[model samples]
Target: MPDQQRHVAILGAGIAGLSAAYYINEELGPAAHVTLLEAAPQCGGWCQTMPQQGNSWFECGPRSFRAANGLETLRLVHLVGLQHSILLADRRMAMARFVFLQGKLMKMGPVSAIRQIGVWNLLRETFVPRRSHSEDDESVYAFAERRFGTGLATLLSAMLTGIFAGDAKLLSVRAVFPLLTELEDTYGCVLLGALCKMVAQAAKAVAARLTGPRRRSLAVAEQWAKEMKRKSLVISALPAYVLADILQASTLHTGANGMDPQAIMVQCVNTLRAIPFSSVAVVGFGLQAEQCPWPRSQMGFGYLIPPSEGQEILGTLMESCTFPDAQPSNVTRVTCMIGKAEHLQGSEAHLVAVAQKALERHLGLCITTGQSAVGVAVETLWTAVVVQRRCIPQYTTGHTKRVAQLQELLHLNAPQLSLAGQSYSGVGVNDAIRVSRELVQLLKKNWA
Candidate 1:
């Protein structure tokens, strides 16, 4: 069969799906006919950038991209001719992260010196025992506490909340922070493992500089065509539950050839549905330059509130500080993320008010009590609110095992089907690109 006869149906138009389509087109070219399916009117999934009243930009979803695991994303940027538009924030500026503790926004310094985390706790982690070989998956909180100390474990909970908007006590340590677990499993200690890895990375970087990068050539068109027997490829980048719902509907129509295939599909669907998702309310505010209460020196990426603080907001990001180009010179922008699934049920105005109160308590920002009100707090020139329900997937305990099972079932019963997106692997723009590109590479290899 000719390569041109092959068809690829990509479900969802999110970053993962789009990247998969792009890479498939780039690598396979006319070899494959790609059909991108998106249920929504707009694409981009949870990555929406909106224009504010003051010519500022408010991200209704994800705001910034991290450098780590972002090489593929950067490559995509260059491929799409967006390299010049990129704005780089100072490394120091991006590194300054704060944690709200005991009604104070505390600057979280290095773990070794931070009094909140305790110097003794750091010293004690080295002597802490590792998990037994028979032991399997455990909650993030449990792993942290067992490896480090209770204080550090508590802090990890807050950090997890900021990232996943999830409870660390429920999140899977192996699934969420695989590197950390691998370090412990291999080196018997997290800190020691990290240091060793850093040294290895430095050595690797030096070696890379000494010898330039080497690119591999793609397989010839003729070879690919000959190897390609699969007529259609279906890559699903939808949320786990959505995909499960789809599978559920499809299975009802499938004629059961045997009990095994039908049973596998049912198991996969149930596992997919079991994966929980967390909701978040992204509230953005555009303010005049003078209205920002904090001095420029004190401003950093933003602050995160630990669940211990008993605050409504998960965290706040200083958007203008990190990406000055995102907003006009006269305007400053900041975003607050409130992630309590129940709280999202409130009206938009009510949610805005909640965010306003949070900002006021955390950053001393002004709040509008009535139609007309004045106070020491600085008022916002404009406000933007976006409530994302069941947005972030929660990698609860046994997530990795569940994913492994799902993969095994799919491989046996549905070889043409593949899964990608935050639901399966890492959650970020970089992860999305990396996963999609990898899937395309795998498809190419299979066909070749």
Candidate 2:
């Protein structure tokens, strides 16, 4: 590089972009100048936290972090100085998640090691393990039924529907569950696959202990280091298609700047457009603490409605119970996600009414008619966030090939550029952080 100090432009100030900026600055020290740009006024795209009256907080998106094996998430929380702010959901509470099935809520307990190894599920696991296909390949329904049988598939349908708000029958299995494909490829049976995973995890634990924490915790640290090495690098963390469009436009200009811009932009656009995404909405409702049906001691994470139930709302998270600071002592917060993007007509009144009814039916709690008024208390607040269209990239069937193509294109045209976000790898926050760190390292090796 001409100089150790370089200026980098990071597009979109979401968690990925922020992580990029933090890494770039930390790795390069004062030598790197990082500017993070967000089309929106604020950063934290879907990870924003809004203040409620009193000492309460309301998350606009991403309410809780899963603690089971979330090293990257823990690292990020510490890196962002939110360790103290981290609230753990009470695991002991009888927080049974209910999936809406056949017009009634069926108790779906939290996933555990034993539950995952049921004999019936194991028998079917050998021949019908969870597998991913290409975009044009088998659908989620087909893949689920094949691996877990119709019963498990039907059971999972509601949970899947709630999370993605997508139709498993139509959604590409490859795009939805890529890990299952890896499990099948590796072990050929879900049970064996899970066993192998357990063994691998045990091995990793032993290795980590033997090597010490410093060596084991380098994924994010190393990534941050790489981003620090680049000058004038653009971190386009938006959806792939959006990045693609920008890249395509840049390719059209004539001149040294135009050519370089066009070449880089084209590569980005092409890579992003190749991935697919699914849109979803999460609508939250606030009820008076006194009116809550479930006792305070019984509170925990809320319920998820399966697709077979044909309910409008996907699932509800016990926001108040999940996070103590999420609401006031006298207030209760319940978040309902409208999973079916196709069914959303984008009407607040309609969404609110649907959510209210679902809550009444499942939780047996009614939302006072007056509470339906907009701009009410945080406990009574309702919000609907719609991702008009998104790319649902799964690590299934030809995922490796598609990623390989993306990598090859980047290598040929924009060697210094890398893509990171939920669309590329995993959808969870940890996944995003992990991928971002990896990309940072790659950028450092090439540009630094």
Best candidate, lDDT:
1
Distance from true position, residue 355, model 1, in Å? 0.8
lDDT of candidate 1 over 378-413, digit per residue (tens):
446788888888888998988877787677566546
Worst 10 residues of 2 by lDDT: 212-221
* Model 2 / residue 74 / CA error / Å: 1.4
Which parts of model 1 are misplaced by more than 4 Å? 1-3, 111-113, 196-228, 252-258, 295-297, 369-379
lDDT by residue for model 2 (359-430), tens: 767665567543332233324544444333453443334444465566555544554455676665556677
TM-score of each: 0.88, 0.78
Ten-residue segment with the worst summed lDDT in candidate 1? 213-222
Candidate 2 lDDT for residue 355: 75
RMSD of each: 5.2, 6.3
